[model samples]
Target: MAETVGDYVLQRLREWGVQQVFAYPGDGINGIVTAFGRAGDDPHFIQARHEEMSAFQAVGYAKFSGRVGVCMATSGPGAIHLLNGLYDAKLDHVPVVAIVGQTERSAMGGAYQQEVDLQALFKDVAGDYLVEVNVPEQLPNAIDRAFRTAMSRRAPTAVIIPSDVQEEAYTPPAHAFKQVPSSPPGLTRPAAVPSAPDLRRAAEVINAGSRVAILVGQGARAAAAEVQQVAEATGAGVAKALLGKDVLSDDLPYVTGVIGLLGTRPSYELMRDCDTLLIVGSNFPYSQFLPEFGKARAVQIDLDGSMIGMRYPTEVNLVGDAAATLRALLPLLTGTPAKAWREKIEAGVAGWWRTMEQQSMVNADPVNPMRVVWELSERIPHDAIVTADSGSAANWYARLLRVRGEIRGSLSGTLASMGPAVPYAIGAKFAHPDRPAVAITGDGAMQMNGMAELLTIARYAHRWADPRCVVCVLHNNDLNQVTWELRAMGGAPKFEESQQLPDVSYADIARAMGLDAITVRSPDELGPAWDRALGAGRPTVIDVYCDPEVPPIPPHVTLEQASSRLRAVLKGDPGGLHLVVQGAKTKLREVLPGQDR
Candidate 1:
């Protein structure tokens, strides 16, 4: 049988060394589905419960594997469903290629069923690159460009294949004038370094300051050792952005945890007290958390020149790969390590961890959500890949969990979208089938999509070499994050119609789907539940009933936030009394004797 366009597409993907493609079936891609069957599932097709979940899984796979992720969908609704996750990949700077099927070319202009103007629809999300393959001759170059652009720009790109065109006989581009041919599949990455002058200037600024602070993001993942070397040389306190949570181990005494509203107190102080700031590979958006505008002489190192010097006023901007640039700068740095400053930062980090423990122990009606993550932190394997969905769950994951060893963690950092945790874990499993993957999610997100993805896990659980995929659901029957945001940010009381979630037994549902399930109502049960789930031979779900009234208090609360909370309580917030009690208890841990400034 002669090769078809769909067959050639898969062949190109194989040439690019793609191991899997996350997708869902639809009639719009009938040709491709048939081709997949004919190809014997080479570059395996990993079916997701939804197109959005497929895109997110691809993003997660790309994030963990350091390779371009690919997701496929059918026309119209399926393509539309992919936008949110594609946007998540775009915003978080993850490379993902979306292959979407379109209506038959003949029926496109006549508004055939499932026909949509996919180019206009995907223009923004896949702004880096978007193309429609109208003929078989466009195959190799179009698909190759999609993958190449997505990887080079670290953004989502798209390729639209018309249904009829997918069935056409494959044809290579001719050696004639108008045909475009692509080079063989493989990208060679260069280690970019800044100019000698910029490195010297950055080194000079670091050498001149008595108190130095360094901030890192996901971009710093490859440069962890170099970051530590710089910290030792300059006696700088290192703080991570949420996306860079796993870049450095929390066990490092001088490593202040995440820096932002959900960041550690030591991180806040590290930014506030520093005389000089060094931002490496992090585009952390919260400028208010950094040192006052003119107080600190700042230097930034990033691979993208467009992003440099935008967040803060920097004395020197070095556009280069983080590890290579830092390696170059190391020899130029002549700073004397400030023992006193390093000691103070270490002391603050120690106190902050103590405060986190105290906060986790605070009483709640059922379980303090913080305690759930704290317990997991105690038992999570060294090589586990942990994912957290957005909401109050992120607060606990950010503050309570400590990442060490080869552990990798990420979320919708820039987009802050919910429902990616479970899918991300699914993608992580594909990325590393030998390692255990865990997802921390809230009830709202679990109901939104996490629950459906459990079936996907159950379906694929048998394929994993180490089948310990655990989804820990914070079963608080409330949209807890937005509920707190309404009170703290808008001074509005919790509107139950929108804030309250209908309770569902996630564990029961998981068991029904042929996976291990554990339910925890008491704080003491959390540790044992986690152990069982982690040791389980298959996928597991731990549904812990959490306190909806527990507030995710920020490290540094402003008077305005306090006033808003007070106004919310006075304005008849439903959980007013319980909210006050929990908030006060959670915050009290910070001022305790052992948690000294």
Candidate 2:
């Protein structure tokens, strides 16, 4: 039975549960595209503009959906274009499987059109590359291996499906590889405990502590309930790094707060006041900001023994998982809790938490970006997936958002990047078009990549599905934040870049591209504009002209950079005179502020 190699590739992906492949069709890959269109059974190919955007969009889908995100490109240049996104996904630890069309197998050494060593080109970017000449029989094995490697290592895998092989076939033998769902861990722990006396010694130390604090990390997320139980037994206050936010309910009274650079200073101060700081599950990077050994005794716990003392110096190091360690230590704990020490620590935490929260509030009426995003967050539908592009907008999102229910944070689980949010929103829409997906992009970041992807929504709506996507642009007229940053860095004023951006208009550009565009310059117009845009329900762009400086540098950042940047903006080249006008304009604006436009 002769079958097209393209058909075999489709069946292999179907077996592996790949429902969508984000792509930009090219003549070199027409056979596969046609085969994909006919596969039916609810599988669909999403067409993207540049193959680069397609790759990035696929990476996002892979990361959030925990599925093998598939992308495809034609041979040579098309395949070359996917490298950036492939590398991005690789570095970000995402599972992406890229399928690049290749020159006919027989044309390899003849310098064929659009032919090159595609495998060598993508070697570094992909964790694994499979150049399969035959489909049907060989393709399934390669697809299985690609998914296994990608799922385990979270790196991209690229498959080279040469053109001529598309028409070849091999009937499947009676036996086929069956797919299975990943199951949760059950019953007993993997590692055993130490001597009973050692466990007793650890528990004794923990029980005698007058004030106890548990610092939660990713490991804690794995056994959050167990960690919570330990905290409940000791009545210790809990603090966590960014990754552990949703591990324990944020609204829990016993949960002190987040502890890190972007977190409240009170948490750090509270840790200093405590007699014991138990580092659980995470080796958070900022040890200097943590309470010093002189201020409090530090104890570290981890599933991997070596991770202890790798970051901060620890007085006690436990070589078991956070949950196991806590369970073992419970029995050894002795002595009644000290009333005075606990009360003083609790008082400090209470006072500090209150003051820190007060600092988060903003009342500026071309409302400060902090207040704006906060209010905007309140308005978003619960379960909405929000992606934030970098720069001032991202900074604000990190500070202002409150995850009350289920949500995907812009920079939560991975190293944050710019230009991802816009394209990511497109992928999110494709993943769950029924739900609201909003991309909050800064003017600078949007201009960096937004021009290339605005029509993805249109393509899906007019070309694939009816559009229900939202693209929100935080349209600050200039790179005001960058200008301020350069002044702080002792570099030449970046105003040269800022002054040049004033003429750019996203609303005009979105309208030009056939998207519903609305520019909201004032707080009063924001709500109504958003409502109208949401109601219109196509690919809509709401350009909110926000004040760039409204994102006040958090306390963690030193003002030294801000001060130096101000001087650089003033004296760097002939911008001295311009800074004077800008500074004065800034002051006048304070007295009688105009629209950010």
Candidate 3:
């Protein structure tokens, strides 16, 4: 039997070492679906409930596996649904390759059903590389380039194939005029390091300072050991960008936790007090949270030259792989250890953890959201892969959850989009079937997409060696994050019509899907509930009723923000009194006796 272009597509993906392709089926992709059947699932087809979830699952797989993620969809609506997740990958700088089926070539310009101009649609999201394989001969080069560009640029790339082309007999590029040939699929990335002169200059900036602070991001994950060595050599406090939360363990005494709006007081103080700054593999966008310009001499090292020195005014910018560059610069650092500065930072970090504990114990309507994550922190498996959705839940995950040991954690850092927590966990399961994966999500996100993805978990749970996939839903019955954003950022009262969420029993729904389920309405139930879920032989959904009025306060609040909340209360905000009480109690933890603040 002659190989069809669709069969060749899967063959090429296999050659590129893709073990699974996250996808959904449709009539437009019938040819490829048929090829999957003929190929006997050599590269497994992981069907997602929707095209968007498929893309997110790929992102999750790529992020955790440190490989290129591939996702597929049919034309038009299926293609359009993939945009958000692809954007999430692009913004978060994850490598993903998207394959989509297009309408038949004859129907493309005729406006046939499901025929949309895919080239223009994908141009921006997959701007690094976008190609339409109009002929069987174009398949090899097109698919190869998509994977290569995705990896080289760390961005989403796309390859579009018309239905007719996918069904045509496959043909390799001829050794003739007008033919373009591609080499076999393989990528060998070089370890790039800055020049010796540049490394010395950066080291000089570090060695001259009496107090140093290092900021690490997702880019620094590979350079964890180098980052620690540099921190020790310079007596620096290390602050992690939210995306790099797992880059270094929170157990390190000099680690100041996450740095940004959703950060700790110690991290804030680390930036405020540092005389010099070393930014590694992080392009953390919030400059306001950093030291005041000119107060600290800064040096930045990143793999991408374009992103270097954009977030701060740096004295030196070294474009290289973080680990390689940091290793080269470490020996040149000759500063005397700032013992006093190190002790101050460590003390602040200690005090901040105490504050977090105190804050978690504060009273609320049913349960404080912080306590939910705090409980998880106490019991999270050392090797767990944790993911958090964007919402008020992210606030708790950022502050309360302490990532330690081999625990890997991530979320939509740049996109900050909702509804990827469960799908990410699903991807994590596929990435490492032997490890336990946990997801922390808000009620709003669960209702958006997490509920449907639970069935995906139930479907694949048996394949995992360790089937402890836990989805912890913060059931607050409100769009809590945006509701608080309206009050704190816009001085607007919470309009119940838009902020309120329909109450649903997520645990009951999970139970219906044949997974273990638990419900917690009291703080006392959190620890035990987590234990049961983490020990479960299959996937589990934990629905905890959290307080909607508990504000996600930042490490430092401006006077204007305080006034805005006051105005919101004066303007008859819903839950105004409860908001004030919870906010006060939560914030009081920072200023209490023994706290650094």
Candidate 4:
């Protein structure tokens, strides 16, 4: 007469397009674990040793399949461990459902065993959270909300499932719940563009400006064609925010390059030289690169009303979607392509490509960041989903690795956290088992994240990309980059401790977990190691001993930030002191390498 809670959840998940649930079991979730075992078929159960990896695995799976990724963990520290990975999903806009088993409702408040304020802890990171503590029927809507939120916002959603209730029996629905939609998404566009006055002002600025540039962001992904048209017709050039890289063809004539610290010089110079800059989509974070207030006129079009003037000031704030806004701007422009200025932007773009070709060939003895990621881009299948960790890893990936369209990817576009890559890779793999998935992680990222997720890869061990997924550990094994930043900011400790992390032999860790693993000592060994990883498929671990100091932040970063973080360290704030001595900031880029070129 009574059905267990796990069955109820699993049964509903199947109807919702969630085929599997990844999680690490614990005493806290005994009932759910038992229920999962008894759930027969359909929504399969995945066992991950570490809670963090369970969430990571979900991220990887979600990327390709475009399905809802589900991962579970027991209450207390176990559930807490999943937060970092969840934050990753939230930041990258992955539609993930994290089912956390809470402490028995009775002992929850007092911390029965490993309990903490799980909801409060996760609040800052997740796009939203759902706590299901009551009637079983209520779960369907909560689940529905999680799925819908994830898709609409492209972020992670948390579902806290209490332990006592996990096994509680309930009637099964005669039919399954509605499936989650993953693709061919829609948007609500305003019937009209900005007011006539604003449009007139923007037009006047465009008319007066000889050299104009257009900067696009992640929101421009859907408006690629419209954006390209505007660029071509107006003699305007294109500069992209990091998330906008794949929005347009890399070789588009008017695209100079990405603009930011990881960005190329061409984009920067173009932005500086251009008289008017049109921001198609994005509240791009970096104001440093934006034209100084009085220097040049800038216009921004966005869907969110609150986004206007959130970061860089805008002369014209058009409240509309990117596609529609561009379409509106297209007709207003009477000027033919200004051949001279257009030629200038094109030259800069051509120079960047030329620079890329020249530097990619640089055979540095120790192996450079550019070569590592460039070669990786070349070696990995074009369709492979490349997930990246924060820090130097992002910079390396941003500059060297080329994303072949919106194949598959997950990264903290704004938050820029580490550790997400590993968990995201797991999620991506689960969502799309048929596609090759890989995660690029720096030593700092793995150190902060659960190393045990490597074990999760071996559990399903499905043959997708044969060695369908691989982890390339850029093993500088230290937070050297952060320490330098701290030191520069005048915060580094006088007696800087060698915060270098002990060499983590991921190969050994992977082998211990029954996964194929290899460690490359030099550039020469990298190819062979990759071949083994790729050739054998299944999940393989490739740990490469590369320099952590070789960051991807523009070399100008070496000049140091205006605030001397190191000088602050010398002033003796113990926590601050520890970070500086530990070289924490040095590892900030976990993905952004030092000398990417």
Candidate 5:
């Protein structure tokens, strides 16, 4: 049989090394789904419970695998459902390609059933690359460009394929739609390298500074060693943005932990005190946490020229790939080792972790959330692909989990959304089936997406060669992060009735889905339960009941924020006073010393 337009699309995906696609089917996309069904084992179509999950799974796949993530949806609502997850990809700068099934071309303008203006709807989210296949012959090139644009830009791309066009027989093009470039369609061009003059300028700025600091972001993830070398040569201390948490080890003497609200005190101190700041690949948004404008001479290195100095004033903008730029700039500079700065960062980080350890070890009436994260972090395999949902769970994992060598993971950092943990784990497992994958999620986020997606894991759990997937649900029975935020903002606990979840057995739900599952109510049970989950060598869910009152406190607290907490407590909010007393008694002891009652 001659190939169909749908067949060409699937073939292009396979040619580009996309082995799996997360999808949810509807009438509008029946043709493409049928084509995917026929394509067989190469590009296995994973049927997710919702289109949102399909998109999130794709995001997770791309993050862990370093390849373009692909997801598909039917027209109208199905396509609309993909926006949230696609936005997650866009904001996080992950490469994801979304294929939306449009109505038949003849029916599009008539406002027919399930006819959504896919282009119009996706403009803001997938505007970087959004195209609807107008002709059957355009499918191949469109597919190729969509993938290439997504990969090169590290953003979400959408292709709207009409069902009628998908069903049409594919024919060789009469002539090219546009001139074919010399390089292959899906291959990305090399990142720009900095000019000698730019490199020399950046080098001069750094060499002239007495105290230097480097702030790394997701852009510098591949340039960890280069960042370390630059920091070492310049006598600089390193502070990573939250997205770049795994780029370097927290144990590095010159490395401070994350910067910003979820950051460490040492990191904040570094940014405040540095005389010169070298920003590589991180357009970190929190300018308030950055060095004061006039206090520091700044230089930035980025592959994207537009983002080079968008976040801060730059004295020297070195527009190039982070590692390459640093390598080139290294030889031009007269480097001096700032032993004083490095030692200061090391001591601060040490003291901070010591305080964190004390807080994490406190025994609450229910299991402390920090303890759960700490135990899981300690037990997971070094190579495990860990994912955190955006909530208190992300905060705990950020503060407590020490990602050493080869422990790669991701969070919904930029979108700051919840419910991605489950799909992320499933996708990570598919990408690296031989390795273990873990998802640390909260009760609210777990119910939102993970609860349904757990069944998706069950359906394909055996397909993976050596599946060892773990979903650890921190069942605090409340939207703890939001509740804390309300208290932090001087508002009473108004969301408790709305945000507090019913005490349902997540472990029971997992068992019903035919997976090994357990619920832990005490700290002692935490370790054994984790051991069982990891050792099961199959998909497992461990529901650990955590203390909902514990706060995900930031490294620094302003007087206004402290006053808000006090106001909330004075207003008779249930957990506010308890949280304050707990902080005073346990968390503040190491830091406040004599002030702790």
Candidate 6:
């Protein structure tokens, strides 16, 4: 049989090393779907319950494997549903390729059913590349460029294939599709390294400062050892952006936890007190968490030149690959370590961890969410891959989960959207079949997507020999994060209509999907529940009933936030009063004899 446009597209995708393509079947995409079926399992096709989940699973695959993820959807609504997850990939700087099926060329733009302007719909989210197969011959080049651009730019790209174009015969003599391919595909260019002059300038800035702090993000994933080397040589305290949490271990003496509201007190102190801030691979947008511009000199190193001065003004900007840049910059620096600075940072880290341990141990009626996260942190295997959804669940995850050695995970960083954890866990499990994959999500986020995703997990549970996928649902029966945000942001009253969530049995939902499920109503059952899920040898869900009143208190709260808490308490919110009391309790610690007081 002669090759079709759909066959060429799938062939190119296989050449690009796309092992798994998240896809949903539809009439408009039947040709491509059939082509995928003919290709066998080299590039396995994963069927998602929703188009959104398909795209999100792609994002998760990219994040865990450090490779470009691919997703396919049908025309109109299916394509539109991909926008959110694609935007998550874009904002998080992960590579993803989206192949969307479009209406037949003849039916487009004539008030026909399911006819959407693909280019216009994807303009903002898929900024790196977006093109339609208007001409049958254009499919080959479009597919090539879309994957290439996505990998190079670390952003999402889109290719729209019209139904007619997909079915066109590929008898190519005048087109490049049948021509001799140059160098076979899938070869990628190496990332640029820092120049000598940039290294010298960066070294000079670091050498002049007595107190240096190193902040890293996902860009530094490959440079963890080099980052430690630079920190040791320069006597710098290391602070991780949320995306870089796993780059360094929490127990490391010089390593401070993440920065921002989901960050640690010691990390805030390091940022505030450092004389020179060296930012590598992170475009953390919370400038307020950084030291004032004039107060501290800054040096930024990133693969993207445009992102160099984006987060903070830099005295030195080194545009290059993170590991290479760090390696080059190390030799130019003075080897003198600042002993006093290191001691101070170590002391601060110790104090902060003590406080964290205390907070994580607090027993509250209805199980405390922090205790659940803390217990899981202690029990997870060394090679586990963990994920967390947005909302109050993130608070416990950010604060309690410690990433060390081979243990790694991710959260929705810039996009901060909910409903990705369940799918992300499935993706992560697929990416590393032998590693334990866990998803931590809230009641609201679980209900939003977890129910459908439970089926996705059950479908693929038998594919991998090791069945260690777990979903920990924090069942608080409220939009707990937003409820706290309303009070913390000074909103007058908590609107019950928008803030409360219906009580539902996530365990039952998981069980109905043929997953091993357990529900824990008390803290005593937490450890055993986690152990059971970890050893279930199948996809499992642990529905934990958590306290709804625990506030995700920020390390630093503004006066306006304080006012908001007061107002919320005055307006008769019991949860607000709990927050206020917690604040007072924290303050009272300063007056205790064995503490800082």
Query: After superposition on all CA atoms, what RMSD does each candidate show versus the true structure?
Result: 1.4, 6.3, 1.4, 6.5, 2.0, 2.3
lDDT of 2 by residue, 76-124 (tens): 8999988877877875567788888888778887998998888678778
Considering summed lDDT, which 10 consecutive residues are worst modelled in model 1? 588-597
* TM-score, prediction 2: 0.76
Candidate 2 stretches with Cα past 4 Å from truth are: 109-113, 128-136, 171-250, 253-367, 412-415, 461-468, 479-484, 498-502, 511-515, 527-539, 569-597
Candidate 2 backbone collisions, by pair: 5-166, 486-565, 487-564, 487-565, 487-566, 488-561, 488-564, 488-565
Tell me which of candidates 3 and 5 scores higher on lDDT: 3
Q: What would the per-residue lDDT of candidate 1 be over residues 1-597, giving only the tens digit for each residue?
A: 899999999999999999899999898888899999999998899999999999999999999999999999999999999999999999999999999999999887997888899999999999899999998888799999998898888999999999899999999998879899989998877899988887888899999999999999999999999999999999999999999999999999999999898888899999999999999999999999988999999999999999889889999999998999999999998979999999999999998898888888888989999999999999999999999999999999888889999999999999999999999999999999999999999999999999999999999988899999999999989999999999999999999999988878999999999989999999989999999999887899999999998888888999999999999999999999999988988887877744422
What are the models' TM-scores? 0.99, 0.76, 0.99, 0.81, 0.96, 0.96
Summarize candidate 4's per-residue lDDT along 1-597 as a digit string, tens digits. 477767767766777767788877887778778776777745777777678777777766765565667888887888887876677677656678887777777787774777777678667766465555544555566666777777655678877777777767764333456422222223333444677677777777776677888898876777889988878777998887886776676667677667788787777887777878888777688887877777788788876676676766677788877787677777777766789999988887776665554454444435555556767766767567778887777777677665565455546677676677877777677666677777888788777763667766776665344447788887776664565445555545423455567776888888888877888776777667766777775678787777543434452454455245545544763445444323333333232333432
lDDT of each: 0.93, 0.66, 0.93, 0.69, 0.85, 0.86
Clashes of each: 0, 8, 0, 70, 1, 0
Error at 171, model 5, angstroms? 0.8
| TM-score of candidate 4 against the unseen true structure | 0.81
Candidate 2 or 4, higher TM-score? Answer: 4
* Candidate no. 1 TM-score: 0.99
* Candidate 5, superposed: residue stretches over 4 Å from native: 176-185, 592-597
- Model 2 RMSD in angstroms: 6.3
lDDT of 4 at 21: 84
1-597 in candidate 6: lDDT tens per residue? 778888888888888888899988887888898888777755888999999999999999999998889999999899999999999999999999999999999998898899988899999999789998776666567777788889889999999999888888864435345543233567466868877887898899999999999999989999999999999999999999999988988879999888989888888999999999999999999999999878999999999988888878789999999988888888888857889999999998887766765666566657878888888988898899999999988878887797776998898999999999988888887788888999999989888887888898999988877888999999988898888888888655677889888888989888888999999998899999999999888889999998777667777777988788788888988566666655565544423424431
- Candidate 3: lDDT over CA atoms? 0.93
Off by over 4 Å in 6: 173-183, 582-597
